[model samples]
Target chain A: MDLLEYQGKQLFARHGVPVPRGGYAATVDEAVDVADGLGYPVVVKAQVQIGGRGKAGGIKIAQDRDECRAHAEAILGMDIRGLTVRELWIEEASDIASEYYASFVFDRAAKATLAMLSTKGGMDIEAVAEEDPSAIARLHIDPLLGFQDYHARRLCFEAGVDADVVRPVSALLAKLYEAYVAEEAMLVEVNPLIIKQDRSVAALDAKVTLDDNALFRHPENAELRNPSAEDPQEQMAKERGLTYVKLDGDIGILGNGAGLVMSTLDVVAQAGGRPANFLDAGGGSKAEAITSAVEVILSDPKVKAVLFNIFGGITRCDEVARGLITAFEQIKPQVPFVVRLDGTNDQEGRQLLADANLPNVHTAATMDEAASKVVEVARA
Target chain B: MSILVDKDTRLCVSGITGREGTFHTLNNKRYGTNVVAGVTPGKEGQDVDGIPVYNTFRKAVDEHGANTAMIFVPPRFAADSILEAADAGIKLIVAITEGIPAHDELRVYTHLKRLGDVRLVGPNCPGILSPGKANVGIIPAAFFKEGNVGVVSRSGTLTYQIGNELAQRGFGNSSIVGIGGDPVPGSSFIDIIELFENDPQTELIVMSGEIGGSAEEEAAEYIAANVSKPVVGYIAGFTAPPGKTMGHAGAIVSGSQGTAAAKAEALESKGVRVGRTPTQVADIAVEILGG
Candidate 1:
């Protein structure tokens, strides 16, 4: 889960890393009030998860209350990268002597947590990497030993960070690493760590993404989720313990595994039909789970056909057939459904479906057959 | 002549008393795996399907002379289970448990690296199968037949689907391994490819990959330099959008990397026959192996 800029700053502060004092506001009045408390010359940043907020005119600096209100009023309702800015982060603007970049991410290539530091900042890291790869210094941290002071210092020297800012930057790196591990974060990025005239360094911008699988350990991070960013069907599927992703097609797909479901989607598109959604009932799915998935699929009015391509490994096809029967009875779905059952107890499952003989229900023996059948029905 | 498991493998199952553990244990035994011992803390006196249960992996190794382990433990204790298996000197460890935290996996991977002798497969995988000889993990054994094709995949059902297609077309497998669906899988495509390349019985190779990491691309490079067997490949998630986790924690595409197109391009550049469909992939395999 990606944290909003303000939330990232708050997390940084909690880890003993100094950040510019900031307040979150949802209204122009609140923004003005926050600016007054911060004593003018504040930065109003749009609170959206998407990037390029500054280039999209979602960030503005205001020297007084009038300008703060004007910036807040303009940014709060503006759409930046298709994400509407519903909130504003009013922060005290810092007087920067220089800017540098720092981040810690799990490097799949190294199989270690990598600390990346660079002298260049306040621009896209990709551009820097593409133009001058030598400017960014990456140091792999052995997860067992963790980030030591020497490791931070090595990164500072290797990245050619200014001598005056190295000590403070190294200290902040340790603190940031602590927060990253404590929160089970996938990434902890400070795009522009600013060195003020006083020689103290502070994180100016933060982009943090916590590991969603580790959310069980940190319940506090749950409050930072933005439900509006998620598809409604996906949210409903999550509530029902089903893995789903909404797509822009008419054939609703249901399967037993993520890989199988993805393959099913491809086969559907191969047959010239777009998939309405990607839904995985997961391993060991029961009738109840299948019923929930079917309901969720039908909930999308764009769906003209439904495809059930289940290759049960741990999942029993008999249970899936029962779930489809129950779902059909409950939803009374008007769309066509092409079902292909295989693996454990697939014979009994397919028999049950064949016996039902419901209208708009078809059966296929293979994935290609099922895809073509569903696409043909959807087109008809 | 199989890579990881064969008729001689002495398999020990960890967490053999749990629901998934007991089920797959029975399935493995039914498929002719020599499952000699089972491990579940505090269940030492019990036996699951005639396989004696032990409280520790050390007992399973020492008492029954077990060399390989199939893990069915839950996510919370899965890492510790891998450590236990490694510490007991198990040569090959296959983990079937899904949803193990990435941090835990990181520690597990790092710890296992120090061991240097153990080969761990999946923490969220279906396991390994040497057809008509021995089977370990959750893969249904009925779809397999003892033959000459070596198969490795990053997917569970897709592997089964393609394997079943191959089996139906008279192309049975020497061994099949699912390397799990996590970002940091215990094994990699290169690991399995190297195994197959070394195995005398594996006349052809089939690699099934999905989006997320560059394991497939790296495996393609390995095949170009090291492998002599005819390789056919199929990559899933071509239709999947970027940044969407397609059911696997490790199966998301970030930015311009880890795309199926890129992987296919890499493999094709290495002279591997890349297929768009499972059936097409099977056809390519049959054409090369002459099944």
Candidate 2:
């Protein structure tokens, strides 16, 4: 749910956070027009969700239309972090006097909405954090009261923002917080909130991450979700309403609950296997859900083996076994499968699977054994 | 003698007219929970599975004197349902609905905090109960039995698995609570830890936590400072790479604090036993309890 910088800036502008005048273009002609409109000394930025775009040569400053078009063409199809540059945001370059960093995200440690502010902005924040962690000022905000004007002011002052910029910066922070809450965002960051020579503060770069669960309330935001950006296997899983996250590994995992699935992943990795994906068939281990999950896992060619680790409670293992048997009929899995089914009707579940006597399917007495068997099979 | 609901504890089901509400309500009643009444707005004076249905939590509480509430309202209305139960003086509210907006949860949580005595378990959780006596939420009814161990987890399936593992090891549960996996949940690890610490029937505790919030760390600190009861901790998502949001809507670890390693380290540092697996958790509990 990460928004591109241009989209983030659009959201920032809606909240009255000033940004350098900009227009997004999807083509070289459009970029030229945009650059012409903005006049000379414009900046062209690649529209991609990932960071390190500047280092990747996705961002360039142009003094004239030719340079703008050239930069836009160079960035338009450039690949940065596996994201192809489909669009470019051309803006009037700002006269930067100083740079600051600010972001609002949920702080798991504090169990509160946290605002991070730092005087150092334009460079890599992670490097700054590693080198001089003290430079960053963090404030935990109570969700009930929200990020109030006073809180924002305190943060701005602590971030070493001068008096001339504090009022506007504080106001902008309050507005950003509002937008974040309204959009159900997980994170809202304005890195390099540039202070011009005139002491006016404006957002030079913006990044926003929205919460997917709250998308039902905001249809517009939900519509903005680009399934194309997601892994094909993950996208397919989502289409079937299964919780799935693809990882760079060979062992495919299928489990009922998040906690159990995660634990299974840990055990699998601990047993010397890499997990291909995190797939949860949810509380209902119905035949259809299991079949869907199996199909999704098999869709990934990287998956060397499949692991079904079921600790059934509300979900009956018998049902899961039926699903696995049914899915085997449908998919005819090419890789090895190691299953560890325990809990409700586990004995019956094992008996049913044993009755099938399917090749390439191995049953383990313990989770560790199951993981070990899967790893062994995947390696073989 | 359990931490929350027992055979004697009176309970009411909220939003009982809904399909999910009625479904779980019937299961709860059939499983021996003393479900005295149900609350469904505009469906008052009716009976759901022979249990009286009231228009509001106040009416249900007033008529039946129900102390515990299990909410099955839709996510959009979950916040109001929690506030209603809280306002009606229901001592314990268990919300089993998922997808509640974070803001709504925050509002409900803040309001409950202001009320100062009422306990809210979850807006997206499976309800809590004493094993083999009074059952609540969607957990399998057959897995639990009456014992001295108390179980609390952020996941429903994990609670059942942990309960089964404990039961298999000849150590049953005093009570079990599935606190759901929502970020801005009504109740937290600290709330359940206090109950498990003070409850006399609970001789040993099994805490099953997932990666996301620092609630586990906070609970570890709480256990370090207070709680003399032997605690066995089995935290999930240990192998999960950092920065990947897990299945639960509330489960996200973008920074350093929410990793499972950090949680395990914090808990282990506090002298609470940590388990790498369900069997390990059971073994740790059995070893500590000398069973």
Candidate 3:
């Protein structure tokens, strides 16, 4: 769902936002050619999903073609937050006089589109927010009215931006809002919207996060998704159409809904074990979905034990028990299994599991007991 | 009395011709919901589950005098469906569809708020219910019993689990509302809290929250300033480390403000008892209700 900086810039360009001329390079030769085409000074940036690439030495300013190639080579295989830099973006360097920040995202508190603008940009925006909370101007945009020019101008003024820069900044904000709404973006951020010495404003760095739920409407954006960027277990889960998010822990969790998975994770931790992943087989989960979910958890080498805490409703408990039994046979997991079944034919579900007579599988009458059992096994 | 939908609440189903619509409509009817009419753009004269189908929400509302609508439309058309329900003077709209674009939801939420007095429940939520009466969306009908505790949550399954736990503890819920996980939803913690605060059957409130936004903090502030009833709160994502988002589209802890600790502290500071575990939620509710 996250777009690399260059891709975000490309999307931004479509909305009439000005971005420095750039080309994505997967090899050293391509980097040199891009630098040559752009003339002498260029910025070679590592294309990774995470931020703070500059501090990590993944971004370098090159004065010549050879320097560009060397920088590109150094960044090509570099790692940022576990994401390898398989590609580099070669962009013409701009003379930045000052850096300002602007972003448009959904604000839950207001239940509306929120625009955040600040005179202080670059570096960690969180740090700036923490240090001078008042420096950032946050605006709740009415979707029906859209982000008008006047709203943008008011935000810029509130951020204490100079009067002369308001017009251009406002125009950029309007375009950014357009891209954000039209593309169904979760986040459209222009950090360090650089002010050049010539009194021109340009988006120096762009970060975009598209809403994954809206991928069905934007096939082009969906195609841009790189499955290789995701963890193998996550990729497998996605292929199976299961909602799986890996976490840092050892207890593997399987549940029927997002809320239940989250609560199960909390309970697992409360009982003295950490959940390795949050896997929701979803409502109306069948044997295949449950089997896929179990396999995905077992696939993770870090997981020490598996927990099935299902509060089945529309999905019958007996059906989930059947799936778990079927998946246990298919997976033949070495890790311990702790099951907690409740709601809708729970008696039948418990009976089926009892009849299975599988080793290393224990059924708990309560969620707490199941969580405790999983924790005990994980610790053991 | 329930907060949103009760036994007296008449309902209409949108997208009733679709498979999902037909399926849930039948389920709703079988579950004893007062489903009066169905709306599918072109399939007006037909009937789904013996409920008359109308071409639009306006026709359904006009004919059946339906006050509530449960939408099963796909994500692409969900926004328009919500707007139509709002325009047609449907007082309560519950959108059960998931995967709606955040921007589209923003538009729908903004429009619904502007319309004023019309309550919207969710775009991705399991909808609201008054136990043993009018059940909306996909929550298990058997897990609930009529009681005094009012439950509201962002997560649907948690609501079900918590409701079941309460039922096991001999504590029945007056109503349960899933405000949903979308960042830009039609209703929020404050909306439900406001309704629960005024409901007579609801003697205690169980607020379930997760990491994301300051809705909990805002609700805490409201409860602090207004509500006099006993409030038991359980916030998820405490063990969920800072900065790691969950499956909810709106789930994100960008900073310390939205952390579980901060929310728990805020709620506790407001005199609301906070439960650290899901099982502990009912215990706190029982204590609050003097059971």
Candidate 4:
């Protein structure tokens, strides 16, 4: 789950990472009140789950009450990269000396945590990575050994952080690492970790993405989940305990495994159809799970047709066939259904579907055939 | 001989008393895998289908001469289970549980790599199998046929899909290994591919990947530098949006990287035939093997 800037900072503060004093506001009046409490020259930043807020005018510094209200009014309800600013984080402005980048991302290839610190900060880090690769200092901390004081020291030294501020920067990096492990964050990033006039380091921005799989251990992070940015179909699916991702297009994809569902989407597209969503009933899926998956798929009005691709391993094809029949009974779906059953109990599953022979239900023999059939039906 | 599991693999089950553990254990045993013993911490002296249950993995290893371990523990305890299997001197560990926290996994990964002798495959995967020889984990055993194409994939059903496709086309597998599609697999593409390359029976390889990470790109490099066998590669999630985890924790695209196009291109450039679909992947493999 991606935390907003305000939430990220709050999380960082709990780990002893220095963040500029900030107050959250939900309205223009609240923004003015927050600025009033924080004194003059507050940075009015929009709270969204995405980046590039400054370029989109979602961030502004207000010197006084009038400017604060103006900036808040301009940003509130404004769409920045398709996400509206519903809330504001008003932080006391700092006298900046320099900006540097720092982050910890779970590196999949190395099977370790990668810590990156660079003199380049605040702007697009990807651009910096492409343009000047050597500008960033990179280190992979073995999760077994963890982030050490010397590791931080080496990283800051390699990044050429100002000698006067390296100690503070190193301290902040250590704290960030703690937040990453303690919070189970997939990504902990601070673009433009600012060095102040007093040579103290503070996080000017926080972009923390907590791993959803680890959320069971950290219940406090549940409240940090921003459902406002979520697609309604995805949210509905989540509530039903289904792994679903919303996408554009008309064909609804339902399958047993992640890779197979994703492959179904690609195949549907390759067969000249657009997929509406990706829904996996998971391994060992039964009839009820299939019903829920189908319900989730048809929940989107845009889905003109639904495809059920079942390559049953632990997931029985008979169970999937039963699911489609149950979904038909409950949902009364108007759109066409293309069902492909393979693997365990597939014959019984196909027989069950054939016996039911519900309206608009087409049985396919292969994934390629299933994709083509669903796309054709949806297009028709 | 097939890579990983074969007729010689004497197996022990971790978390053997749990519902999934018990069910799949009996299922695997029924499929001709050599089931020796099980470990459930406190379930010592208990038996599932007459298979002995020991409290410690060490006892299973010592008493039964078990060399392979299959994990069915819950996500929270799955990592520790893996470490224990390694500590007990199991040569290969196959973890079938999913949703293991990333933090726990990295530590397990580090520990295993440092140990250097033991092999770990999938905390969220369907285990490896050599057709007509041995079967491990939850992959339905009915779909496979004994042949020379070794299948290694990051997904369970997708592997089955292509495996089924191959079987339908008069081809069969030397061994099919499901490494899983998590952010950090206990085993990687390179790890399994190395085994496949060395095995005398594995005449060709089919690699399945999706839209995530540099594992596929790195594996392409390894296949190029090593392996003389013809390779057919398939990647999923061409339509997956950036920054959205499709279903797997690792299958997300971030900032113009880890795309299906990129992974496919990497493999293609390495002289690996890239198939866009499961059927196409099987077809490509057959074409190369036939030639």
Candidate 5:
């Protein structure tokens, strides 16, 4: 889960990483008050979970209370990359001598954590990676041995930071790494780690993505989830313990596994239908769970047809079929449903669905046929 | 011989008293897999489908001589279960549990890799199965048949989907491995590809991949340099939107990275027949194996 800038900074500060003094505000008055309290020249940044906030006019520097209020008012309702800025982070502006980038992310290729440091900051790191790869010094930390001081020293030296800021930067890097591992973060990024005039280093921006799977260990972090950022259907599905992503198409997809759900989306497109959402019923989903999933899908009025494409492994098709039947009884959904059952107890499952023979309920023998059927029915 | 599992694989089911563990254990045994023991802490001395249950993986390994461990523990304990299996000296560990924390996976992955001997297939996977020989994890055993086409994938149902498609077309699999769809999965395409390349019975390989990460691209490079077997590949999530986690945690496209188009291109450039659909993947496998 992506943390808002304020939330990320809070996490960083908790780990002894120095961050610019900031106050989170949800209103214009609060923003002005925060700027007043911070003694002016504050950065009124939109607290959205997307990148390129500045390019999108979601970030503004205000030297006075009027400017702070105006910027807050302008950015609060503004939509940056489809995410509305409901909150504002009012941070004291730092005096920057130089800018550098530092981030610790999971290097999937190496199956290890890598700390990336670069002198070229305040820009897209991907661009730096493509254009000037050598500017970024990557340090892969072995999970067993962990981040040592030497590793941080090497990162600082290789990134070519000024000697005056080297000790501070190295110290900050260690703290950042500590926050990363402690927070169970998939990514802890501080782009433009600004070196102040006093030669002390501080994180100017924070983009932290905590591993959702590890949220159980960090309940406080889990509570940081903002429901406003998520689609209502997705939020409801999450509450129901179902994996769901809202899309723009009309065919609602429900499947047993992630890969199958993804392939179902592809097949639906292949069969000339646009999928409205990706919903994984997950492994071992029962009738009640299936019913909840159907209810969630039906909640989206754009969904013209619901497709149940299940390949039962540990998940029995009969159990899923039972769930679908139970859902039909509870929901009485108006949209058509295309059911494709395979794997364990598929015959009995198919028989159950066939016996129900509810109106607008269609069954196909294969995934391709199911997709074609759903698309055809949805279009009709 | 199959790549990972064969007739000689003595399986032990961890979390055996649990719902999924018990169910798949019976399924694997019914498929003729020699599930010699079961492991569930505090449920020792019990029996699951006539398979002896032990409190620790160590007992399963010590008493039953179980060489393979199939994990069905809950997500929270999955990493510990994997570590336990490795510590107990299980040569091949297949984790069927899903939702394991990424940090825990990293710890288990780092620990397992350092051991240099233990092999892990999945933590959110459908495990590996050699048809007519042995089965592990939650894959439905009925969909498989004994043949020479080795299957490895990052998905559960998609593997079964293609495996079933191939089986219907008279192309049976030598073994099918689900390496899982997490961002930091224990095994990779290269790991299984290397095993398939060296397996004597494996004539060809069918690799199933999806978006997210460069594992497929890297696997394509390995196939080009080392693998002599004909490879047919299918990458899902062509229609997936960028930045959406398309069901799989690792199956998201960030910027230009982890796109199905890129993976398909990489595989095609390496002489592997890349298919746009599951049936096309199966068709290519049949055409290569049948011809």
Candidate 6:
């Protein structure tokens, strides 16, 4: 889950990392109130989960309350990179000195947490990496030994960070690492980590991405999940313990595994049909879960056809057939469904579906057949 | 001449008393695996289908002479189970449990890397099947047959899609390894590819990768420089959008990288026959090893 800029700063503050004093507001009136209290010169940052907000005019400076109100009104309702600004972070403007970049992201290949530090900041890291790769100094931390003072010092020294604030920067890196581990964050980045006119270092911007799988252990972090950013059908599927992603199509897809579901979507697209959603009922899915999956698929009014391409190994096809029967009785789905059942107990499951002979129901023996069948029916 | 598990495998199943553990333990036995012992802390005097049960993994190893371990433990304790099996000197540990936290996965990966001897296959995978010799994990054995084609994948049923397609075309597998779809899988495509390269029975390798990470791109590099076997690669998720986790934690497209097209192009650049579909991949493998 990606945290908004203000939310990331709020997390950084609790971890002993220095963040510029800021207040969040959801309304233009609240924005003016916060800007007035922060004094004359303040920066009003749009709180959306996308980057390049400054270039998109979502970020502005206010010299007075009137300017603050105007900027807030302009930014709060603006759409930057397809995400609407729902909140604002107003803070006192800082005196410029120098900028640097630091971040800790997981290196999936090495299976280790990597710390990247650079002398250049306030620029897109990807552009920096592509242009001058040598500018960024990378280090992998031994997860067991953890983040140490020596590790941070070595990072700063390797990145050629200025000598004046290396000590303070190292201290902040230690705290940031602590927060990274404690919060189970996938990434914690500070772009343009600023050094004030007094040569004091503070995190000017934060991008914290938490591990959604590890959210079960951290209640506070779990609560940080932004509800507005999630698709309604996707969120409902999640609540029902089904793995789902909403896609722009009219054919609803249901499968047993993530890989197979993705493959199903690909096959659907290859058959010249757009998948309405990707839904995995999970391994050894129960009949109740399949029933729920059906309801979730039909909940989308755009869905003209539904596909059940289940290759049961541990997941029994008989149970899936039972769920479809129950869904037909309960939800009374209006659209056609093309079902394919294979693997263990497939004969019994397919027989059950054939016997039911539900209206507009069809059966396919292969994935390609199922995809083509669903697409043909939906098109008709 | 299989890479990991074969007729010689003396298997001990951890969490053997649990529902899934007992079911798959018996299933593997039915496929002719040497199920030597079971390990479930306090379930020592019990047995599943005449296989001995022990209180500790050490007992399962020392008393029954078990060499391989199949883990069916819950997600929270799955890492500790791997450590216990490793400490007991198990050669290859196949974890069938899913949803193990990323931290625990990281710790176990670090520990196993340090050990350097043990091979941990999956915490969210469908185990290994050396056709007609030994079968471990939940892969339906009927879809596979003995042949010269070595297969490795990060998917379960999708692997079956290709495996069954090959079997239907009269092409059998030397060994099919599911490396799991987690971000940090215990073994990578490179690891399994190397195994297939060294095996005498495997004349060609088929890799099915999905969107996520640079594992496939890295594997393409390794194949280009090191592998001598004919390789065919197929990637899923060409239709998946960016930033959405497609069931697998590691299967999401990150920004612009890890796309199916990029992975396919990388493999193709390295002289691999990249297949657009499972059926097409099977046909490519047949064209290489057929009459």
Best DockQ among the predictions, by candidate number: 4
True contacts kept of each: 0.62, 0.66, 0.75, 0.92, 0.86, 0.62
Which digits, one per residue and each the tens of the lDDT, describe model 6 over residues A1-380? 78988889999999998899889898999998888788979999988888898999988989999999999999987988888778899998988698899999977877899999998999999999999999998899988889988899899999999998899999989989988988878899999899899988889999998877787787887777553376778778978988899999999999998888888999999999999999999889988999999999989889999999998878889999999999999988899999999877899999988898888999999888999999999989
lDDT of 2 by residue, A1-380 (tens): 77778878888888778889999898999999998988989999988777799999999999998899789889988988888888788999999999999899865455578898888999888899899988888888888888888898789777787778888788778888888888888789989988898888899999888777678887877766432266789889878998998888999999988888888888888888999999988875787889888999999999999999998876788999999999999889999899999888899999999999877999998777898999999999
Better of 1 and 6 by DockQ: 1
Give the TM-score comparing model 6 with the true structure, all chains together: 0.95
Write down the TM-score for model 5: 0.96
Ranking by TM-score: 4, 1, 5, 3, 6, 2
Per-model TM-score, in order, reads 0.97, 0.94, 0.96, 0.98, 0.96, 0.95
Candidate 1 per-residue lDDT, tens place, B184-213, comes to 898999989998998999999999999888
Which of candidates 3 and 6 is the stronger one according to DockQ? 3
* B15-117: candidate 6 lDDT, tens digit per residue: 8899999999999999999999999998889888799899899999889889999999988788899999999999799998888877778889999999999
- Cα lDDT tens digits, model 2, B1-291, are 887787777888888889878888998889889999999889888998799999998988889899998889888888888889889999888889888877677667767887898888876777887877788788777777788998889987777777877887888778888888988776777788788888888898889998887889989999888888888898898777666777887676765658888889999999988998877888888788876
Instruction: For candidate 1, give the DockQ.
Output: 0.73
For candidate 5, lDDT tens digit of each residue in B237-284?
Answer: 988888778777788898788999999999999898997888888878
Query: Candidate 3: misplaced stretches above 4 Å?
Result: A133-135, A160-165, A226-229, B242-244
Worst 10 residues of 6 chain A by lDDT: A222-231
In model 3, what is the error at residue A256, expressed in angstroms?
1.3
Reference-based TM-score, model 1: 0.97
Q: Which pairs clash inside model 5?
A: none
Return the TM-score for candidate 4, rounded to 2 decimals.
0.98
What is the CA-based DockQ of model 4?
A: 0.86
Runs in model 1 lying further than 4 Å from the true structure: none
Selected candidate, larger TM-score, 3 vs 5:
5
Q: Is candidate 2 or candidate 4 better by lDDT?
A: 4
- The top-ranked prediction according to lDDT is 4
What ranking of all candidate models by lDDT puts the best one first? Answer: 4, 6, 1, 5, 3, 2
TM-score of chain B of each: 0.98, 0.96, 0.96, 0.98, 0.97, 0.98
Tens-digit lDDT track for model 4 on A214-310? 9999888976656349778988998999999889898998998999999999999999999998889998898898888888888898999999898
